[model samples]
Target: MDAINLVSARELARRNGLSFPNESPEYRQARDELLAEEIELRRHIERVAEQRRALPPGGQVRKDYRFQGPDGEVTLRDLFADKSTLVIYSYMYGPQRERPCPMCTSMLSAFDGEVPDICQQVAFAVVARSPIERLLAFKKERGWHHLPLYSDTTDEFSRDYHAIGPDGGDGAAYNVFTIKDGVIRHFWNPEMGFATADPGQDPRGAPDFMPLWTVLDTTPDGRPPSWYPSLTYGSGP
Candidate 1:
């Protein structure tokens, strides 16, 4: 919908009948104002997505990057399976680290449950610089069954995709590729990182992908400042 033709978000919010038990007039007024902003935010998100979808054709893939999956070595095109669109998430789980990045693991844990639904629309693959066997073992340990894990055995894909730093350290990456008329091409990937982060906030892409953060954002005390996800949390339900 065009912004100029639509009613103002404040007017729409003011017309809402939602009310909570024992909520004071002050609370309702403040909430209605916040609701107006939320409506505007939703419109902004839709606008951004529409612009992204309208982008011109991206760069074509030249190199035949290979990865090792449970079955055997597979080319980047093979990762697409039956879908024309593909999404690859390179988690920070290189061989140098004794354990996978807890943050990545946390994100994947949430993704695991949605893989089936996500794959219905586009192919999704989880990649790491670690060996296939190592990745499989960790996947089993985490009880993740749906994530299609692959190993960037040669680091060629990782290097080209900016998942590997100049110092050889691993970094998290999320890339989208599309195949049209049997030609694979790069689609989109978030460029925001440490260099683009705002003051007092961590570097993160727009439309945050992590459900953990999204959930915490709804609480009064949002995500903790110093706290981070761990491989294991000591004794909990």
Candidate 2:
């Protein structure tokens, strides 16, 4: 048989209706397109990121919502960790939920060391509507200390950013903002546009954080149309 190299086993698996073992000419061609697709996707994603960067300053934030730190009495501005750009991932550990969202916990688990790396460049944090003690308890339970954690217990900040919707619903979102010259301006954020609503919340889109694709590159099976687990203190879970 003629030798063919493929770019991605996943694509090869997709194109051939079965898994492609090792790189073949067919695999190579598929891999090339896969590479091209990645670049295109990167550019496409970056275009959206640029849109976030381009948002005009809305003005100074009207409210100074409170959050808790080890010390206490911190405001929204304080959460920035002294970076001009601040990213807050409003987490789903709310007063009503029985547990912190596993997926959100998974994404946040990556932020451990990533916090310091980005903190050197930008401020980053995770906030939840749950009380400070409850949020911290979950933080401890999850072993997530690499990133700064806060509690938007009062509901002011989440409400202003549209991070939280109707009451009796899940709370939290991925929102990025800027504070300059003492004014707060919205920047970027993510949402479940079409994720199916669990019970009470509006129908939202599926949670899409791409880890599966990156992980599957290693062995025979690769990622099976799934998300990848996060890095661990040792090996991943």
RMSD (Å) per prediction: 1.1, 8.2
lDDT of 1: 0.94
Model 2 per-residue lDDT tens digits across residues 1-237: 112443443454346543467768887666666766765565557666676567776456677678876578798788775788888887877777787776677767766757778888888888887778887777787787786777776777777776666665665577777878777777665655545457554333333443433455456876444443433436434
Highest TM-score, which number? Answer: 1
lDDT tens digits, residue span 1-237, model 1: 587898999999989979999999999999999999999999999999999999899999999999999999999999999999999999999999999999999999999999999999999999999999999999998899999999999999999988998899999999999999999999999988999999988888998998899999999999888888888988731
Candidate 1 clash pair list: none
lDDT of 1 at 68: 95
In model 1, what is the error at residue 44, expressed in angstroms? Answer: 0.3
The number of clashing residue pairs in each candidate reads 0, 17
The C-alpha lDDT values of all candidates are 0.94, 0.67
Per-residue lDDT, model 2, residue 198, is 72
